[model samples]
Every structure is written in structure tokens, then in C-alpha cells.
Target: MNVTTGLFYVFSAVLLFAAFRVITARNPVHAALYLVLTFFQAAMIWMLLKAEFLSITLVLVYVGAVMVLFLFVVMMMDINVENLRVGFWKHFPLAAIVGVVIALEMAAVLMGGFRVVDDPNAVAAAAEANNAKELGKLLFTQYLVQLEVAAAILLVAMIAAIALTLRARKDSKYVSPGDQVRVRSADRMTVVKMDATQAAVAPVAEVSEPKA
Candidate 1:
């Protein structure tokens, strides 16, 4: 009917399609690409809803950095696709049951929810101000500890990932950058003074050549 509603439905459809493809696609790289698409669609929807901070964060953090890294990691991994899909049919019933349970739980929770009245004036007011400022206030004032905890968890996870990936292989020829940086010219090159003495001396010519 309205432009916003039309855009919402279009974005929602694309988001759903991308999400489905992420789960159904056999190729891991394709799945990651679809997931990036999903994040982009979700970010657009959030932008439409006036959550600019969250929308930008979604696009920048998830689609830009995280998904790109995930795609690289997925591409690098030696995964066996045939073995991964070995029992899809066997797990169908169980998967369906879990899906149904989640749907029912969401339904039950939503059914108990109270709907807000449409405020035309509030919409105009919201348009005049940035939502991110309010969100920042709420985050810093009310949810600082929770946000800190989440950040701390993320930091720890990052450190753990780096630690897990790093290995000191004795067989591998690796150079320590710190050690390399500390090296002086003497460590890399040697100056032999005997080389100057060994340099060919111009043979003295006869008096005739000197006169010429």
C-alpha cells in the first residue's frame, strides 16, 4: 500500500531468501556469501526503522569484516561436503520437530505481547532526532556493565582465537620480527679490510707510456 510497507516487504523477502540459502546451500563459501547478503538486508531494514547506529554496525562489523573473514576461513578449510550431507534425510524429522518447537514458543511469547498505539506525532519527532544518541545514553547509563561484559567476552574470544591459531613449529622456518628488528648492520654484513689490500693495483708502466 504505502512506500515504506512496500520496501519493508521487499527487503523482508530478500532477507528470508538469503537466510534460507545460507542454510540450504551445500557450498560453504556460498553459504557465507548468502549470510553476508542476509546481514545487508537486515541492516537496510534496521535503517528504514530509524536504527542507524545498529544498521551501520550490522553492515560494517558483520557484512564487511566478520563475513569477509568467515568467507576466507571457509574457503581455506578442507571440508568434505559429501560426508557433511551424509544423513540429511535421517535428521529431517528431528530438525522439523525442533523448528516446530521454536515456532510455537515464539508464537506463545508474541501472543502475550501488548501492541503499541500508532503515534503520528511521535514519528515526526523521531525523524528530527538521531536514535543512536538515545541508544548510547541507554547503553552507557543503564547497560554499561552488560555491554562491558559482552566486550570483555569478545576480547577474550579474539585472544583465544589468535592463541589457538598460533603454533611454534620447530620444522617450520619462521623468523621473529622482534629478533629481526633488533639486528644491526654487523649481524647481516661483514666488512673485510683485507679486501682493499687484495684490490688490483694499477701496474706502473714504462717511462715511454708516462711521457705519452
Candidate 2:
């Protein structure tokens, strides 16, 4: 009906399309990029909804940092596309049904439940005044448990990534920085100062050759 409504629909369409492509896309890199697009669209929608703190945070953290790292890893990894697609046929029906059910549920929950308000924010600087401080307070107070859960999830992801990339090679050596930092040259090398005194006592031996 108005600009906000129009923008909402546009952002919604982009988010939906990108989310769909995230699962359906064959390339892992493409999937990551689609996911980035989805995050961006959601950020925009959130901004329109006056959730500037969350919107900016989503852009800065997820789209900027996390997704960039994901894209880098996906692009560098040796992912087998053909092998990945092998079970696509077998999984498609279940996946599609699950996707449709989720979509329907979300639609049912959102469609008639939303009420548009006439509040256009009392002050333009109100969001800026409260942005980071409010978010930090809320995150550290009300949503602390959620924040911890997210951290735990990220830690698990990091562990999974490490496990995926871990390899042992017979020819290669690995050392921890902490271990290296604690090591001393005396532990690794022998230093003999017996130098000059030992040198003076050593005499040249006469060489003897045997007939071949």
C-alpha cells in the first residue's frame, strides 16, 4: 500500500528466494553467497521495522564477518559436487515437504497476525541514541542465556571445522604456539664452551694408507 509495505514485500521476496537457493543450490560457495543475500535482505527488513540495532548487527556480524569466512572456506575447500548431489534424488521429496511445511507454518503465523502501526518513531536520533548501548544491555542482561547458547553453537561449529580439516602426515611436524613459547634453547640444543682448552689438547694424527 505504502513505501514500507512495498519495501517489505521486496525484501521478503529476496529473503525467501535466497533462503530457498541456500538449500537447493549445488555449489557450496553459491549456497553461502545465497545465505549472505538472505541475511542482507533480512537486515533491510529489520531496519524497515525500526530494529536498527539488530539490523546493523546482522549486517556487520553475520553477513560481513561470518558469511565472508564461510565463503572463503567453501571456495577453498575440496568439496565434491557430484558426490554431494548423489543423494539429492532420494532426499528431495522429504526435503521439499519439510520446506513446504515450515513455509506454511511461518506464513500462517505471520500473515494475519501482523498489525501495522502509525508510529514513525518520535525522534530520528532515538535509534542512534539507544543502538549499541541498548543492544549491549539487553544482550548482557535479558538475552545473556541466548547469547551464551549462540556462543556454544559457534564453538561447536569451530570444533567441527577443526575436526574436518585435521590431518596427520608422516613427513610433517606440528607444534603448539604455547608449547613453543614455553620451550628453551637449552632443552633443544647442547652448548659446549670447552672450546679453546679442548682445541689446544687435540693433536693431529698421522694418516696411514693401506694398499688397495
TM-score of 1: 0.75
Q: After superposition, how far is residue 158 of candidate 2 from its true place, in Å?
A: 6.0
- List model 1 lDDT by residue over 71-114, tens digit each: 88888889999898888879978987998899899999988885
Most TM-score-accurate candidate: 1
Give the Cα-based TM-score of candidate 2 against the true structure.
0.62
lDDT of 2 at 18: 97
TM-score of each: 0.75, 0.62
Instruction: Name the runs in model 2 displaced over 4 angstroms.
Output: 110-133, 143-170, 173-212
Candidate 2 per-residue lDDT over residues 112-198, each given as its tens digit: 887665566745556457666887999999999999999999999999999988988889988889999999988999977755544
Clashes of 2: 0
